[model samples]
Target: MNATVNPLLVPDPATDHILGPADARVTLIEYGDFECPSCAQAAPAVKIMRDHFGRQVRFVFRHFPLREVHPHAELAAEAAEAAGAQGKFWPFHDLLFAHQHRLGEAHLRDHAQQVGLDMARYENEMRDHVYLQRVQEQMQVADQLRVRATPSFYLNGAFVDVSFGLAHLQQAIEQALAKG
Candidate 1:
Protein backbone atom coordinates (compact mmCIF):
# COMPACT_ATOMS: atom_id res chain seq x y z
CA MET A 1 0.00 0.00 0.00
CA ASN A 2 1.21 3.47 -0.85
CA ALA A 3 1.16 5.88 2.08
CA THR A 4 0.93 9.60 1.59
CA VAL A 5 2.68 12.01 3.97
CA ASN A 6 0.46 13.94 6.31
CA PRO A 7 0.56 17.63 5.53
CA LEU A 8 1.37 18.39 9.17
CA LEU A 9 4.60 16.40 9.00
CA VAL A 10 5.99 18.48 6.15
CA PRO A 11 9.23 20.17 7.11
CA ASP A 12 9.12 23.83 8.04
CA PRO A 13 12.31 25.64 7.12
CA ALA A 14 12.18 27.36 10.47
CA THR A 15 12.36 24.19 12.58
CA ASP A 16 13.07 21.10 10.53
CA HIS A 17 16.66 20.44 9.46
CA ILE A 18 16.93 19.75 5.75
CA LEU A 19 20.14 18.06 4.68
CA GLY A 20 19.68 18.95 1.03
CA PRO A 21 17.82 21.62 -0.92
CA ALA A 22 14.35 22.08 0.52
CA ASP A 23 12.74 22.63 -2.86
CA ALA A 24 13.90 19.36 -4.37
CA ARG A 25 11.34 17.15 -6.10
CA VAL A 26 11.93 14.30 -3.66
CA THR A 27 11.51 15.03 -0.01
CA LEU A 28 12.48 12.41 2.58
CA ILE A 29 11.55 13.14 6.17
CA GLU A 30 12.91 10.98 8.97
CA TYR A 31 11.68 11.07 12.55
CA GLY A 32 14.69 9.73 14.41
CA ASP A 33 16.44 9.65 17.79
CA PHE A 34 20.10 10.54 18.06
CA GLU A 35 20.78 8.02 20.81
CA CYS A 36 19.02 5.25 18.99
CA PRO A 37 21.39 2.54 17.84
CA SER A 38 19.20 1.90 14.82
CA CYS A 39 19.27 5.55 13.92
CA ALA A 40 23.04 5.64 14.35
CA GLN A 41 23.29 2.76 11.90
CA ALA A 42 20.98 4.45 9.45
CA ALA A 43 22.88 7.77 9.43
CA PRO A 44 25.48 6.64 6.93
CA ALA A 45 22.87 5.15 4.65
CA VAL A 46 20.92 8.41 4.69
CA LYS A 47 24.09 10.20 3.69
CA ILE A 48 24.67 7.74 0.89
CA MET A 49 21.19 8.36 -0.45
CA ARG A 50 21.73 12.11 -0.28
CA ASP A 51 25.02 11.69 -2.07
CA HIS A 52 23.46 9.54 -4.77
CA PHE A 53 20.46 11.77 -5.33
CA GLY A 54 22.20 15.11 -4.84
CA ARG A 55 19.98 18.10 -5.57
CA GLN A 56 17.11 15.91 -6.68
CA VAL A 57 16.19 15.09 -3.08
CA ARG A 58 15.44 16.91 0.13
CA PHE A 59 16.15 15.07 3.38
CA VAL A 60 14.64 16.38 6.59
CA PHE A 61 15.65 15.19 10.05
CA ARG A 62 13.15 15.73 12.83
CA HIS A 63 13.52 14.92 16.53
CA PHE A 64 11.71 11.84 17.86
CA PRO A 65 13.55 11.05 21.04
CA LEU A 66 12.14 8.02 22.89
CA ARG A 67 12.63 9.18 26.41
CA GLU A 68 11.24 6.10 28.14
CA VAL A 69 13.68 3.83 26.37
CA HIS A 70 16.51 6.28 25.96
CA PRO A 71 17.01 8.67 28.82
CA HIS A 72 19.75 10.57 27.04
CA ALA A 73 17.85 10.88 23.76
CA GLU A 74 16.03 14.07 24.65
CA LEU A 75 19.22 15.74 25.81
CA ALA A 76 20.95 14.75 22.60
CA ALA A 77 18.12 16.32 20.64
CA GLU A 78 18.47 19.41 22.77
CA ALA A 79 22.17 19.48 22.09
CA ALA A 80 21.56 19.35 18.35
CA GLU A 81 18.95 22.11 18.53
CA ALA A 82 21.24 24.24 20.67
CA ALA A 83 23.97 23.83 18.10
CA GLY A 84 21.47 24.76 15.41
CA ALA A 85 21.15 28.09 17.16
CA GLN A 86 24.84 28.53 16.33
CA GLY A 87 24.41 27.24 12.74
CA LYS A 88 26.07 23.94 13.62
CA PHE A 89 23.14 21.53 13.85
CA TRP A 90 24.30 19.18 11.10
CA PRO A 91 27.76 18.77 12.53
CA PHE A 92 26.37 18.33 16.03
CA HIS A 93 23.83 15.88 14.69
CA ASP A 94 26.49 13.82 12.95
CA LEU A 95 28.62 13.84 16.06
CA LEU A 96 25.78 12.76 18.32
CA PHE A 97 25.00 9.78 16.17
CA ALA A 98 28.65 9.05 15.60
CA HIS A 99 29.20 8.96 19.33
CA GLN A 100 25.80 7.84 20.52
CA HIS A 101 27.06 5.93 23.52
CA ARG A 102 29.19 8.84 24.61
CA LEU A 103 26.21 11.15 25.22
CA GLY A 104 26.04 12.88 28.57
CA GLU A 105 26.38 16.41 29.86
CA ALA A 106 30.12 16.47 29.31
CA HIS A 107 30.01 14.60 26.00
CA LEU A 108 27.30 16.90 24.73
CA ARG A 109 29.60 19.80 25.54
CA ASP A 110 32.41 18.05 23.76
CA HIS A 111 30.15 17.65 20.74
CA ALA A 112 29.33 21.35 20.88
CA GLN A 113 33.04 22.10 20.85
CA GLN A 114 33.61 19.62 18.06
CA VAL A 115 30.96 21.35 15.99
CA GLY A 116 32.60 24.72 16.72
CA LEU A 117 29.59 26.08 18.55
CA ASP A 118 29.98 28.74 21.17
CA MET A 119 30.36 26.48 24.21
CA ALA A 120 28.99 29.08 26.59
CA ARG A 121 25.86 29.62 24.51
CA TYR A 122 25.38 25.94 23.84
CA GLU A 123 25.71 25.05 27.50
CA ASN A 124 23.23 27.73 28.51
CA GLU A 125 20.69 26.73 25.87
CA MET A 126 21.20 23.05 26.46
CA ARG A 127 20.44 23.49 30.14
CA ASP A 128 17.16 25.23 29.40
CA HIS A 129 14.11 23.99 27.52
CA VAL A 130 14.73 26.43 24.73
CA TYR A 131 14.22 23.91 21.94
CA LEU A 132 12.09 21.44 23.85
CA GLN A 133 8.88 22.86 22.45
CA ARG A 134 9.84 22.13 18.86
CA VAL A 135 11.14 18.69 19.79
CA GLN A 136 7.88 17.92 21.58
CA GLU A 137 5.95 19.06 18.51
CA GLN A 138 7.91 16.62 16.36
CA MET A 139 7.33 13.87 18.92
CA GLN A 140 3.63 14.62 18.68
CA VAL A 141 3.88 14.33 14.93
CA ALA A 142 5.35 10.86 15.38
CA ASP A 143 2.53 9.97 17.73
CA GLN A 144 -0.03 11.18 15.19
CA LEU A 145 1.58 8.95 12.61
CA ARG A 146 1.42 6.01 15.08
CA VAL A 147 5.16 5.79 14.91
CA ARG A 148 6.57 3.62 17.73
CA ALA A 149 10.21 3.56 16.79
CA THR A 150 13.13 5.49 15.48
CA PRO A 151 14.29 5.96 11.85
CA SER A 152 10.82 6.25 10.34
CA PHE A 153 10.87 7.65 6.81
CA TYR A 154 8.46 9.52 4.58
CA LEU A 155 9.36 10.07 0.94
CA ASN A 156 7.66 12.69 -1.23
CA GLY A 157 5.17 13.11 1.57
CA ALA A 158 4.42 9.41 1.73
CA PHE A 159 5.27 6.94 4.52
CA VAL A 160 7.86 4.72 2.92
CA ASP A 161 8.81 2.42 5.76
CA VAL A 162 8.66 1.94 9.52
CA SER A 163 12.39 1.27 9.64
CA PHE A 164 15.58 2.59 8.05
CA GLY A 165 17.55 0.60 5.54
CA LEU A 166 19.41 1.78 2.45
CA ALA A 167 17.72 -0.74 0.17
CA HIS A 168 14.15 0.17 1.13
CA LEU A 169 14.87 3.88 0.94
CA GLN A 170 16.67 3.54 -2.36
CA GLN A 171 13.85 1.57 -3.95
CA ALA A 172 11.17 4.00 -2.72
CA ILE A 173 13.24 7.02 -3.74
CA GLU A 174 14.01 5.47 -7.10
CA GLN A 175 10.31 4.94 -7.75
CA ALA A 176 9.53 8.49 -6.74
CA LEU A 177 12.33 9.79 -8.90
CA ALA A 178 10.99 7.88 -11.87
CA LYS A 179 7.49 9.23 -11.33
CA GLY A 180 8.76 12.75 -10.77
Candidate 2:
Protein backbone atom coordinates (compact mmCIF):
# COMPACT_ATOMS: atom_id res chain seq x y z
CA MET A 1 0.00 0.00 0.00
CA ASN A 2 2.88 2.35 0.68
CA ALA A 3 4.13 2.30 -2.87
CA THR A 4 6.62 -0.55 -3.19
CA VAL A 5 7.17 -0.86 0.54
CA ASN A 6 4.82 -3.65 1.62
CA PRO A 7 6.12 -7.16 1.15
CA LEU A 8 3.88 -10.09 0.32
CA LEU A 9 2.38 -11.72 3.40
CA VAL A 10 2.18 -15.16 1.83
CA PRO A 11 4.43 -15.99 -1.07
CA ASP A 12 3.60 -19.68 -1.01
CA PRO A 13 4.22 -21.36 -4.33
CA ALA A 14 2.64 -24.71 -3.61
CA THR A 15 -0.88 -23.27 -3.32
CA ASP A 16 -0.62 -20.43 -5.83
CA HIS A 17 -1.76 -20.29 -9.46
CA ILE A 18 1.56 -19.55 -11.08
CA LEU A 19 2.50 -18.64 -14.62
CA GLY A 20 6.02 -18.88 -15.96
CA PRO A 21 8.91 -20.90 -14.55
CA ALA A 22 9.03 -21.69 -10.85
CA ASP A 23 12.61 -20.56 -10.65
CA ALA A 24 12.09 -17.23 -12.32
CA ARG A 25 14.07 -14.42 -10.72
CA VAL A 26 11.23 -11.92 -10.42
CA THR A 27 8.02 -13.06 -8.78
CA LEU A 28 4.89 -11.01 -9.57
CA ILE A 29 1.83 -11.80 -7.53
CA GLU A 30 -1.59 -10.28 -8.11
CA TYR A 31 -4.37 -10.30 -5.55
CA GLY A 32 -7.30 -9.83 -7.89
CA ASP A 33 -11.06 -10.09 -8.24
CA PHE A 34 -12.75 -11.44 -11.36
CA GLU A 35 -15.44 -8.74 -11.52
CA CYS A 36 -13.18 -5.79 -10.83
CA PRO A 37 -12.83 -3.42 -13.76
CA SER A 38 -9.32 -2.43 -12.81
CA CYS A 39 -8.37 -6.09 -12.51
CA ALA A 40 -9.91 -6.74 -15.92
CA GLN A 41 -7.78 -3.94 -17.36
CA ALA A 42 -4.81 -5.47 -15.60
CA ALA A 43 -5.35 -8.89 -17.17
CA PRO A 44 -4.05 -7.84 -20.55
CA ALA A 45 -1.16 -5.94 -19.05
CA VAL A 46 -0.22 -9.01 -17.07
CA LYS A 47 -0.22 -11.06 -20.26
CA ILE A 48 1.94 -8.44 -21.93
CA MET A 49 4.31 -8.47 -19.00
CA ARG A 50 4.57 -12.25 -19.18
CA ASP A 51 5.33 -12.13 -22.88
CA HIS A 52 7.81 -9.30 -22.47
CA PHE A 53 9.57 -10.71 -19.46
CA GLY A 54 9.54 -14.27 -20.83
CA ARG A 55 10.90 -16.56 -18.13
CA GLN A 56 12.46 -13.78 -16.10
CA VAL A 57 9.26 -13.15 -14.19
CA ARG A 58 6.85 -15.59 -12.62
CA PHE A 59 3.23 -14.47 -12.19
CA VAL A 60 0.88 -15.63 -9.45
CA PHE A 61 -2.81 -14.78 -9.14
CA ARG A 62 -4.54 -14.86 -5.75
CA HIS A 63 -8.26 -14.35 -5.37
CA PHE A 64 -9.42 -11.13 -3.63
CA PRO A 65 -13.02 -10.76 -4.61
CA LEU A 66 -14.52 -7.52 -3.23
CA ARG A 67 -17.92 -8.97 -2.53
CA GLU A 68 -19.49 -5.70 -1.37
CA VAL A 69 -19.29 -4.10 -4.79
CA HIS A 70 -19.11 -7.05 -7.12
CA PRO A 71 -21.99 -9.36 -6.26
CA HIS A 72 -21.04 -12.12 -8.70
CA ALA A 73 -17.32 -11.81 -8.07
CA GLU A 74 -17.05 -14.31 -5.22
CA LEU A 75 -18.85 -17.07 -7.08
CA ALA A 76 -16.77 -16.28 -10.15
CA ALA A 77 -13.64 -16.73 -8.08
CA GLU A 78 -15.03 -20.05 -6.90
CA ALA A 79 -15.78 -20.99 -10.49
CA ALA A 80 -12.22 -20.15 -11.46
CA GLU A 81 -10.96 -22.42 -8.69
CA ALA A 82 -13.14 -25.18 -10.08
CA ALA A 83 -11.62 -24.57 -13.51
CA GLY A 84 -8.20 -24.61 -11.91
CA ALA A 85 -9.03 -27.98 -10.45
CA GLN A 86 -9.35 -29.06 -14.08
CA GLY A 87 -6.08 -27.42 -15.17
CA LYS A 88 -7.76 -24.47 -16.86
CA PHE A 89 -7.33 -21.57 -14.44
CA TRP A 90 -5.69 -19.13 -16.81
CA PRO A 91 -8.11 -19.71 -19.65
CA PHE A 92 -11.10 -19.42 -17.34
CA HIS A 93 -9.55 -16.32 -15.80
CA ASP A 94 -9.23 -14.75 -19.22
CA LEU A 95 -12.79 -15.56 -20.14
CA LEU A 96 -14.14 -14.10 -16.92
CA PHE A 97 -12.28 -10.86 -17.41
CA ALA A 98 -13.19 -10.74 -21.08
CA HIS A 99 -16.88 -10.89 -20.30
CA GLN A 100 -16.86 -9.08 -16.99
CA HIS A 101 -20.45 -7.94 -17.43
CA ARG A 102 -21.77 -11.50 -17.59
CA LEU A 103 -20.61 -13.22 -14.40
CA GLY A 104 -23.99 -14.71 -13.54
CA GLU A 105 -24.36 -18.41 -12.67
CA ALA A 106 -25.20 -19.36 -16.22
CA HIS A 107 -22.27 -17.38 -17.61
CA LEU A 108 -19.89 -19.01 -15.14
CA ARG A 109 -21.05 -22.42 -16.34
CA ASP A 110 -20.56 -21.26 -19.91
CA HIS A 111 -17.04 -20.11 -19.15
CA ALA A 112 -16.26 -23.38 -17.42
CA GLN A 113 -17.49 -25.26 -20.48
CA GLN A 114 -15.48 -22.96 -22.76
CA VAL A 115 -12.35 -23.85 -20.79
CA GLY A 116 -13.12 -27.55 -21.45
CA LEU A 117 -13.64 -28.53 -17.83
CA ASP A 118 -15.59 -31.70 -17.12
CA MET A 119 -19.12 -30.28 -16.87
CA ALA A 120 -20.39 -32.86 -14.41
CA ARG A 121 -17.43 -32.45 -12.09
CA TYR A 122 -17.40 -28.67 -12.48
CA GLU A 123 -21.08 -28.43 -11.62
CA ASN A 124 -20.75 -30.78 -8.68
CA GLU A 125 -17.76 -28.95 -7.27
CA MET A 126 -19.41 -25.60 -7.81
CA ARG A 127 -22.67 -26.73 -6.24
CA ASP A 128 -20.75 -28.09 -3.30
CA HIS A 129 -18.73 -24.84 -3.08
CA VAL A 130 -15.64 -27.01 -2.85
CA TYR A 131 -13.18 -24.21 -3.55
CA LEU A 132 -14.89 -21.51 -1.49
CA GLN A 133 -12.57 -21.97 1.46
CA ARG A 134 -9.50 -21.75 -0.76
CA VAL A 135 -10.81 -18.52 -2.26
CA GLN A 136 -11.67 -17.12 1.18
CA GLU A 137 -8.23 -18.08 2.52
CA GLN A 138 -6.56 -16.15 -0.28
CA MET A 139 -8.82 -13.17 0.46
CA GLN A 140 -7.80 -13.35 4.09
CA VAL A 141 -4.17 -13.34 3.04
CA ALA A 142 -4.85 -10.22 0.99
CA ASP A 143 -6.52 -8.61 3.99
CA GLN A 144 -3.51 -9.55 6.13
CA LEU A 145 -1.31 -7.84 3.57
CA ARG A 146 -3.59 -4.75 3.77
CA VAL A 147 -4.68 -5.12 0.19
CA ARG A 148 -7.81 -2.94 -0.05
CA ALA A 149 -8.20 -3.22 -3.78
CA THR A 150 -8.21 -5.68 -6.60
CA PRO A 151 -5.15 -6.22 -8.80
CA SER A 152 -2.85 -5.43 -5.92
CA PHE A 153 0.52 -6.47 -7.32
CA TYR A 154 3.80 -7.38 -5.71
CA LEU A 155 6.99 -7.71 -7.73
CA ASN A 156 9.75 -9.72 -6.11
CA GLY A 157 8.01 -9.34 -2.74
CA ALA A 158 7.59 -5.57 -2.97
CA PHE A 159 4.20 -3.97 -3.62
CA VAL A 160 3.83 -2.42 -7.05
CA ASP A 161 1.13 0.26 -7.20
CA VAL A 162 -0.76 0.27 -10.45
CA SER A 163 -3.17 2.89 -9.15
CA PHE A 164 -2.05 5.64 -11.51
CA GLY A 165 -1.73 3.36 -14.50
CA LEU A 166 -0.38 -0.02 -15.52
CA ALA A 167 2.73 1.63 -16.94
CA HIS A 168 3.86 1.92 -13.35
CA LEU A 169 3.54 -1.85 -13.09
CA GLN A 170 5.67 -2.32 -16.21
CA GLN A 171 8.17 0.14 -14.79
CA ALA A 172 8.28 -1.76 -11.54
CA ILE A 173 8.85 -5.01 -13.38
CA GLU A 174 11.64 -3.38 -15.37
CA GLN A 175 13.19 -2.00 -12.22
CA ALA A 176 12.90 -5.36 -10.51
CA LEU A 177 14.50 -7.15 -13.44
CA ALA A 178 17.23 -4.53 -13.47
CA LYS A 179 17.93 -5.15 -9.81
CA GLY A 180 18.88 -8.75 -10.48
Best by lDDT: 2
Q: Candidate 2, 114: how far from true, in Å?
A: 1.1
Clashes of each: 1, 0
Model 2: weakest 10-residue lDDT segment is: 1-10
- Candidate 2 residue lDDT tens string, 67-180: 999999999999999998889999999999999999999999988888899999999999999999999999888888899998898877777888899999898888777877
TM-score of each: 0.93, 0.93
Query: Once superposed on the true structure, which residue ranges of model 2 sit more than 4 Å away at CA?
Result: 1-10
Give all candidates' CA lDDT scores: 0.84, 0.88
Model 1, position 159: C-alpha lDDT score: 75
Q: How far is candidate 1 from the true structure (C-alpha RMSD, Å)?
A: 2.4
lDDT of 2 at 63: 97
- The ten-residue window of minimal lDDT in model 1 covers 1-10
For model 1, residues 1-180, the per-residue Cα lDDT tens digits are 124556766778998898778568788889899989899999988898899999999889999999999999998898889988888888888888889999888998887887788877777777777988888988998898888888888887677774545698899888888986
Cα lDDT, model 1, residue 64: 94
